[model samples]
Target: MNIAEFKKNLLQDKISSAQEWFFIISVSLLCMIVFISSDVFLPFLPEMTKYFNTSMSLSQMSLTAFIVGLSLGQIPHGLLSDRFGRKSILNLMIPMFLLATLGCIFSKNIEFFIICRFFQAISASACIVIGRSLFSDVFEPLKAQRAFAVLVPLVSLSPALAPSIGGALSIYFSWRSSFVFVFIFGLIISLFVFIFLPETKPIEKRTKNLSLLSILNNFYIMLTDLKLLYYIFIVCFSTAVWWVYAAGAPLMFHKMDYSAAIIGLLYLPAVIPYFTTSLIARSLLKTKSVNYILNIGINGMMISCLLLFLLESFNALNVWTLMISVTLVTGSNGFLLSTAMSAGILHFSKNSGLVSGLLGTLQLLAGAFSAALIGLFANVFDKHYYVNLTILFIVCGSILSYVLKRKVIKHEAIKSF
Candidate 1:
C-alpha cells in the first residue's frame, strides 16, 4: 500500500466509535480478563496447598503477589502511555501478560507459581488500567459515563465469577488447570486487543518530558485535586468492600456449611448487585448531577449499614442476609463510581494516563489496607466480626460524607497544578 493508505489504516487501527455496543462489550471483556487473571486463582488455593505441601497461608501469597504487582505496575504503565502513546503501551502489555500467563503454566512449584503470579499481576496491566485510559481518552463526558456503565459490571464480575470458575476448574481438573485456563484467556484477550482495540492516545496527545519530575508532579496534582479526593474515596471504598468480602468469605462460608460448589454460587448473589448497579450508575449520571449522585451514594451506604446491623442483631445473617448486604453495598456504589472517576480525572485532561494511573494506584492502596484489617479481624470465634465490618463501612461512609460537605482540599497537592 502507498504511504497515504497506510496512514489511513493506522488511524483506523487507532480509533473506535464510542457509540457501538460491540466496542463497549469488547472493553468490558478486556477489563474482565485482567480481573479474571488476577483472581481466578483463589478457588484453587486450597488444592494447590495440598499438591505443593504448603500451608494455606503460603498459598495465599499467590493472591497477594498479584495485588502487589498490579498496584506497583499501574503507575509506570500509565506514565509510559502518557509519554509514548496509549495504543502502543497497551499493545505491549498484551504480550507481556500472555508471557506471564505462560509462566504460571510452566511453574514447577509454589515458589515459581507465586513468582509468576506476581509477574502475571504486573503484566496484566494490559487489561484494566490501560483499557481505562483508552476509554478515558476517547469518550466525552456523559457518553464516558455510559462507557463506564458498560465497563463496571464486567470488571466487578471478575471477583464475583472468579471463585466459581476457579473452584469448578479445581474440582474437575487440577488446580494447575485453572492457571492454564487463565493463560488461554490471556491469549484470547491479547488477540482481541491487538486487532479490534484502537489506540486512543493519538500522536498529538503524547507529551515531552515524561521525566520523573513530571510524573512526580502529576502524582502531586492528583493527590491535591479537592474534587478528586471524594472520587478517590468512592473508588477506594467500593474496592475496599470487595477486599473485605474476599478476605472474610472463606470462613463465613465455612460457618454456613458452604461447600466449594455452593460457595461458587454464593458469589453470584453479590455479583447481581454489582452488574445492576453499573446500569443504574450509568443512568444516574445522565439524569442526575454529580453532586446528587454523590449525596445519594453516601447515604445509601449508611442505609446498607443499618440493614447489616439489623441482620446481625437478630443473628439471622445467614447466606441471604450476607448476600443482600454485599449487593446493596456494591450496587449503590455503582452510581457513585462513574461520577467519581469521570470527575476525578477531568482536571487532568492533558495528562490522562498519569492521572488514571494515580487514581488506580490510590484505590488499590486503599483496598490493600482494608483487606489487611479484615484479615486481622476475621478470627473464627469472633461472631461480631461481621458487625464490626458493618461499622467500618459506616465509618467509610461518614468520611465520604465529610469529604463531600467539607470540599476537602489537598493543600500540598494544589501547588502542583
Candidate 2:
C-alpha cells in the first residue's frame, strides 16, 4: 500500500479501538455515579449532624432522601430514554445533577441540604439505568454477563473510595467540599459522555406508546414474571445488606471514638475481597452456570451470617469482627449481583430500558429502606443489633436463592420428561 493509504488504514484502526475502550469506560463510570453520590459523604454524617444541630437519626435522613430520589427517578428516565433515546435524556439529567450539586454546596440549612441531595440522586440515577441498558442493547446474554462482571468490580470501587475522599475533604475543609468534588467530577464526565457516548437505542426500536397507562401496563407485565421477580428479590436482599452496613458502620465507629478518616480507611479492607471474588466470578462464568455462581454466593452469604451470629453470641462483636463479616458478605455479593442482573436484563432484552429502570428502582429502594430502618431505629438498636440486621437480610436472601434454584430444577426436569 502507498504511504497515504497505509496512514488512513492506521487511523481507522485507532479510531475503532479507541471507541470501544471509551464505551466500556464510560459505561463503568456511569454505573459508579450513583454509588459515589450516595456514599461519598457518609464519613461526614457526624459533622453534618453537629453543624446543623440535628440528631444523628435526622442527619441520616439526608442519605435516605438521596436514595429515595435515586429509586423513584429511575422510572421516568427509563421511559423517556425508550421514547426519546438515551443520549438526550442523559444530556438533560447531567445538567440537572450539576445544578443539584451546586444547591447542595450552597445550602444554609439541613432541610435544604437534604432536598438538594434528593435532586442530586434523582439526576444521578440516569447514569446507572442508562449505563446498564447500553450493555443489554449491545451484547447478547453471555457477553453481557461477562461485561457486568468487569463493570461491577469497577463500580464497586466507588463505595470503597468515596468515604476516604469524603473523610479527607471533611478533615481539611468541610462536608461541603465533598459536594464541590462531586460537582467537578460530574462536569468532567458529562463532557466526555456528551462527546463520546453514542446513542445505543435507535429510532426504529424506540417505544411508541409512552403514555401513563402503557407505562403502568409494562410494569405489571414485568412484575408478574416469576423468574424476573425472583431475580429482583435476590438483588433487593443482597443490596439491603450492604446499605445497612454502609449506613450503620460509620455511626458505630464514631461512637467508638474513631475519627472520620479512620472510619473511611476502614472501608478499604472489604473492597479487596469484593474485587477479587468478582474477578473469580468472571473466570468461572466460562465453565460454571450462572446458577452455580449464584449458589456459591448464597452459601458465602449464609456462612457470613453464621459467623456474625457466633461473634455476637460470644460477646465478641467488635470492629474487627464486624469487618470480617462485612468482607465476606461483600465478597459474596461480587458473585451475585452481576450474574443476576445480566440474566434479568437478558430475559427482557427487547424492553431493556424499562426493565433496567424497574431493576434499578427496586434495588435502590431496598437500600433506602434498609438505611432508613437503621436511622429510624438507631436509638432502639445497639451496634450489635446492626450486625443482627445484616445477618437477617443474608438469611432471607439465601432462602430466596434456594427457592429459585429449586424452581429451575423442577422446570428442567419436567421439560426433560
lDDT of 1 by residue, 176-235 (tens): 787788878777776666765666677787878877787677678777666666677777
The backbone clash count of each candidate, in order, is 0, 0
The C-alpha TM-scores of every prediction are 0.87, 0.85
Candidate 2 — which pairs collide?
none
Q: List the residue pairs that clash in candidate 1.
A: none
- Prediction RMSDs, each to the true structure: 4.1, 4.4
Output the TM-score of candidate 2: 0.85
lDDT of 2 at 8: 45
Best by TM-score: 1
Q: How far is candidate 2 from the true structure (C-alpha RMSD, Å)?
A: 4.4
lDDT (Cα, 0-100) at 97 in candidate 1: 75
Q: Global lDDT of each model?
A: 0.72, 0.81
User: Candidate 2, which segments miss by more than 4 Å at Cα?
Assistant: 1-21, 41-64, 106-115, 171-176, 251-260, 312-318, 380-383, 411-417
**Per-residue alpha-carbon lDDT of model 2 for 1-417, expressed as tens digits?**
243433343323323444545556778987788888888888788888898888999888998798779878887888888888888899999999999999988988899988999999999998888888887776656666777887877886887788777877876888888888898889888966786565667788899998889888888988877778777877787788878877787777887788866877787777788788888998898899888898898889989989988998999977887888889988998888877887787788878878888888888778778988988987755567788788778877788778876886777688789
